[model samples]
Target: MRFKSLRKSNQVFIFAALLFAGLYYGAGLLVPLTFAVFFAALVLPVIYWLEKKTGIGKPFSSFLGTLLIFIGIGILLFFFVQQLGVFLQDIIESKDQIISYLRKVQLKAADVTGFSLQEQNKLLEESIMELLNMTQTYVSGILTGITGLVLNFLLVLILMFLVLLNRDKFEKFLMMYIKPERQEETKEVIQEARKVAYKYLWGRLQVMTILAALYLVLFTAYDLRHTGLLILFGALITIIPYIGPFISGTLPILFLIIFGGTVEEIISFTILIAIVQLIESYVLEPIIIGSEVEQSPLFIILAIILGGMLWGPAGFILFVPIFSMLKIVFDHTKGLEPVGYLLGNERPGSKENLMEKIKRKIGRKN
Candidate 1:
């Protein structure tokens, strides 16, 4: 009996390990697919409301909603490219100003830090030349990237249509394996998953939009060059979590310093970024994320870190949903319920300091 039990335990462990590997590989391939599904969940209610109010069929409503998503994307892309073009033009126009600013900075740095202009100029020249070379190399890379993007876009569209067309069948398919006694629990998990996914995607979109718009207003107000482009970048990059903000913020600062803009303008841009991040973190984040996904604060931060460490930005975007699904599975299993509760997020503002926050996040159960 002991031998048999040990063998069974080993078999279970092996199966679980294999399952994890499969899931990780599958997730890498289906990040784009996951993105489409997340959006579909968000727009599902709208589709239903439209269908109910106007007598439209589900398929037709799905197509219309997909079209709306495409149209909004088209507009955002148009603005982004337009801004990029204008920013590049401004860069070229301000070439002389940039060189002058470099000379001033070089002089100031030498006075303060005892660096030599010749060395500074040599370093700067090498960097600029390297960037130019990199841009040329990126041309081919861009073509490949564009091809991948088009493929993913079509795939997302197809999935949205199929998911809508066979919604009832899909639900049945999901529940087919579960025992009759557990069907209700399975249904509840599915419902909760859908709600969390919807809240998350929509909340993220709304916050990103607000931050981007705020950037545009502040950049323009400060007379920063390429304000529109930087704003578009702000909107786009905030989708990537913590790292995105730093990058999008750096670009505008670069040209501001490059063009010898007033210290006032630079200061304004800095203040604006600091404020937007604060607002997003403290106000918008809690409001959108509050008690919804059932993820612990530590897990959420770990998701961001691991996503960044492993797969870069794509990981961060997909991390929360992936973990939420895992939590559902864990919740369903008898022995894993305690673990699931620990993996979930604790409420914020219930602590006085960082250590307290960590304790609350980690010490959820006795």
Candidate 2:
């Protein structure tokens, strides 16, 4: 019995290694395909609504849904571009001030470290050359990537439209692999997975929007420089989970530090951001996205790290939902319930907090 258990463990480890290897190697194709599927899932209801209400053909409905998504993306891009212009203009306007600040920083460093001006200038020159080389390399890569980006975008739209149109057929395809007795259970699990993905992504968007609004209002009232760009970045970066939020919150504080803000002003801004983040994490998320994914925090972090390793930035966004869907599959499969529970966010002995209780009440009402 012990030998059998050991053999099974080895098999599991081997399978996991193979799975990760396949994912990493196939990521170029799989990442965009995953995005396509996710977008298809989100827009499926709209397609259904269009078909049922307008008596439109499924193909036309799918096309319209995809077009709507394209328009939305275009709007966001336009907005970001406008804000980016403002950001660049601000920097250009403050160029002299920025230079003055940099000189002060350089002198302070020299004073503290007892380095001569010539040595410092030499070090600076070397650093600038290194940075220029890296910038050249990155620019070349970006030029190459532009073509791939366009092709991937087109692929995603086409795939999304195809998936939306043939969603039922895809369901049938999945059913073919299951025994007749288990097919119904598998179908339920698939539906739940789709629902989970849609809910999580939609909830994330709502959270980001609310956070952006809060940042905009506060930063504007505070008369912060480059408020538009800062607010836009702080909100959008929250989509990447833990590390994203940290960077988002730290950036404005760092900017203030570099630009010589009053101590009181920095402290106030820090407190305000902390409160906003608290509201987002403790209030908005629990109320909006509660139990939708239900995966443990540790598992989500691990998934993000593994995803970054496998698929770069896209993996950071995709892997959490992917793991959540896997948990649903595990929960419904025989002998895998324990694994599912392990991935879940349940605290076996803890009582629900006030925020959680409020979430429960709101969920019940909804």
Candidate 3:
């Protein structure tokens, strides 16, 4: 018995090490494939609907679904790119205004610090030159990599189409490993995972939309320039969670500072963003995303860190859903319930969090 237990532990450790090695080294191919898989999950129901309602063949329906996904993404990219251009143009046009604002700040700093205006001006010029140089380097890097990005995106689309078309084949392939008695459970796990992926992705989209709407109203009220650009950026960047929101908030404030918005506007915007973030964390996410995935906060953060280490930026967005799906599989598999529970948010003895309780009440009402 002891020998068997030791062998099992060794096997588990070897399997894990091999898995990590593959994930790290195979990222170039795996990242896009993983994205395609999740993207298929997100739109699988739509493909089903098209096939059922339109009485279309699977290939046509899959193609239609993939095309719709591409169109939706293309529209977003179009708006983002267009708005980005407008933002850069506005910045260029306001160069004189920005300089005037900077000069005022320089003078104020000189007065407070008992420094000469010329000295301050010299330092400011150097700082601005450094910033411009850094920006140029960043842009150059992006330009150099643009071809690879486009190719990867095309690969993802193709894979998404194929995955959608052959989903049943994939299901059959998975079932080949399971005993007939457990096949039903395996199917249930797959269905649950699909539902979780769809719900989480859709809920995130809804959150982004609501955030954009809120930002639109706030920016309009403050009479901020390039409101569309700011709103789009603020909404999209929050997809990465903590760091994303920080960048989203910081960029707008930086724009206001550079473009000469009043201090009152800046302060108010900061406070409102904090409030909005609070509401998003405590309210919108819990209600909209629900407890379906039941991922614990610690495990989610760990997953993000591990994913980032393994797969870079894409990992940040993909790992949460991946883990959620894994949790479903774990829970359904015999002897793995403990592992699933460990990944889960619920605790047997602990009281429910405020949001969870509220979610329970809302769910009951629904």
Q: TM-score for each prediction?
A: 0.83, 0.84, 0.88
- Candidate 2: where are CA atoms >4 Å away? 1-6, 85-95, 104-148, 348-356, 359-366
> Native-vs-model 1 lDDT?
0.73
> RMSD, model 1, all Cα superposed?
5.9
Higher-scoring candidate on TM-score, 1 or 3: 3
Top of the candidates by lDDT: 3
What's the distance in Å from true for residue 33, model 3? 1.4
Clashing pairs in 1: 295-344, 295-345, 296-344, 296-345
Candidate number with greatest TM-score: 3
lDDT of 3 by residue, 1-366 (tens): 999999999999999999999999999889999889888888888888887888999999888878988898878877876776666556556666767788898888888998888888788877875775566566456556656777888899999999988889999999999999989988888899999999988888898898888888877887778888888878887877677778777877787777787878889888887887777777787777777865888888888899999999899988888899999988888899999989998866234545678678999999
- In the range 112-150, model 1's lDDT, one tens digit per residue, is 988788988888867875674565456446544665666
Q: Weakest 10 consecutive residues, lDDT, candidate 3?
A: 347-356
